[model samples]
Target: MLDPQRTISALRELQRRTGDAQGAQRVAYTAPWHAARGFLTAQLAELPVTVDTDPAGNLWATLPGASDQELWIGGHLDSVPNGGWLDGCLNVFAGLEVLRRLSEQYDGRPPVTVRLVDWADEEGRFGHSLYGSSAVSGHLDPQRAATLTDREGVTMRDALAGIGVDLQHALKAGTQRQKAVAYIELHIEQGPVLERQNLPLGAVLGTCGVERHRVTVTGRAAHAGSTPMDARQDALLVLGRLSQAVYAWTAAHGGVSTIGSVTTTPGIPTSVVETCTFTLDQRHLDPAGLAALWDHAQRDLAQFSADAGCTFAVSPLFQIEPVPFHPALIGACEQAILDVTPQAARLPSGPLHDAAEVARAGIPTVMLFVQSLGGLSHNAAEDTLDAHLDLSVRALDRLAERTITWIRAAERHGARIPAAP
Candidate 1:
């Protein structure tokens, strides 16, 4: 029942509306994002679902069922600057396809309610990522949300109000917790793992725990021409050494660590750098492992910096505990993949997603991944083949169908729902 032609046609229209030479520019709280939201609203106009927006700007289209129990499926529509077309938006539109197909199959109402969502600000361009999902999950810190400012010194609170969302109301929205049984999302692998294995689809095991830090190295500035290599304390050199160490750490260990951005104060060609700052994004599947890695990184990097006559400072940005998918949900997803395709692979996601927040909120959560063409994402060149995308969409539709059956069966027996891991 998954219509590839309809889905692909919708994708073409989205790309035409929101896409540009630089790829998708649908950043949250921006004009393009608002336009894209309007487009989505138009698409849902003919459906039986009731569409509404939360205080945090999350868009929801709810279709009633015979029972009050609900299943939420969604992903963010916002993207990083020059991000790929399919990174976050694929799950959302694909969810719409599932809803459309389900609507055509049922008579008056389906056995279980379904809500398709488009979470806001999963890219975290303002301050923190997963803003909308975090608010929905009741994990948002009011103090933090109240003070977050964007590049132009505009507070997130004002930005939300500009789009008709109140911060206080947003916080309150989490209290109206519907009977959401599970949250499912489909995403591109954004890495080469599935492609290397020649797999079209993979069921996500869980989202990785993350530790983000801003590291600064300070050293005495010296004249580049006058100071000898042994005599000069170069902050840039110290930063280079520390970066290499971090790379080695992740290489030897079984995780991923990245320094995506760097800045140097007094970055003059004729002068030794006085200060250098860089960001660290560390990911691991286990909390214990992530903790150990952080502890060792701080201690070892400090010594490494000191050996180069520089002082090292690390400012913690955020820490997300590892979240594993519920066993029942994982099994359902795996079975759905098998039913749709000849083979399926199991993998853990290194990138954080909105599903992580839903899992934290105690709703069972799982994800599906389509293969990326070359492990590229968050860039204009990021992409996946149409065949791969179509296959993943079909698998997700099958998963949703299976999940409906599971939820209805559980409701029938008055079975106790299992807690999320």
Candidate 2:
């Protein structure tokens, strides 16, 4: 019922107007976010919806249905530095389109309320991924506020303060909604599986577990010309071998892993490198595998460093266990995919998203993934065709309808959401 091409252009422009080469671009509480947030809020007025911001800075736009509260139909709006257009933008815009189209298609609202959410800082510019979603889910510890920092040494307190959000509240992990409802987040697959298979849409299996760490390699700096290879403790060589081992392990395990960022000191050509550090991000479908990997990596650090003539250490930055979306919600997504495109399949998510946090919050949440052109994201070149976008929006609309109906039925029968406590 809508041209997704226009929506994509509008979204891309929103990014262009706000992103910057410096600072964490498009981060929460940043000027770019303000620009995008302002645009989105202005758009909400057309739908005759009521809007408000939550304690954790999550912006909520509500369209009332026959039932109580809202269906919470949207997704995060934050992005990685210079992230692609479709990542979280698709969810927010597509959900808006769903509401608009639903208004035109059906004379009355669906059986339940619908809520559009733009969760703050889903990218966690301060490295708190799912920050907003997790805060609302009562998952973030209030005392951990002191631990977060950006590259410029700006704590979450300062960054949030710049946006007029109080850091103290961000710690509370506020009220969990206990309602007769389900959540459906539509996102790009961010991987090559669907595109390689020529699939237009797919059902989300689940969000994978994540183990991210900061590994530091320390070695003595020496004069480049004077020190022989045998005498010098070169950190880069040790890190190189460590990187290869990490990549090979994750690849062999049917999971995913990578060294996403690398940092080295003193870029002088003549100076022997004194220190080099790197960030290792590892993911898997099971917690046991993650733990095993972490254990092995920790155990190997001593010998690996000794053999490579450097000192290596692995510090656990963050760990999130894999989360399964509700089975019924998943089934509804499958049916919706079949309705829109015949070539849809089920695949687990490699990239972490808000759906994982929502699922952890005890909501019966599920996701529908559109095919990415080259299975690439967090890049300017990431893309998906309009057909795929249309397929995703249609599937999400179907999911919203089914979920609303299910919620109403469940409420009538006194079904309850299990408490996160």
lDDT of 1 at 262: 89
- Cα lDDT, model 2, residue 118: 90
lDDT scores in order = 0.84, 0.76
lDDT of 2 by residue, 194-223 (tens): 888888888998999998888888888888
- At residue 298, what lDDT does model 2 achieve? 67
Q: Which stretches of candidate 2 lie over 4 Å from their true place?
A: 1-6, 12-16, 19-25, 103-109, 171-173, 417-421
Task: List clashing residue pairs in candidate 1.
Answer: none
Measured against the true structure, the TM-scores of the candidates, in listed sequence, are 0.94, 0.92
Q: What is the lDDT of candidate 2?
A: 0.76
lDDT of 1 by residue, 1-421 (tens): 5585676677668777887998888888898898888888898987899998887789999988887888889988888888888888899889989888888888637788899999989988765778888898998886767787766788888888899888877766685356898789999999999999999999999999999887898998888899999997788887677677887777767688888778897888989999998878889998877887787688877787788888888876667899998788888888888887898899999999999999998988899999998999998898888888888888898889888887877776786364321
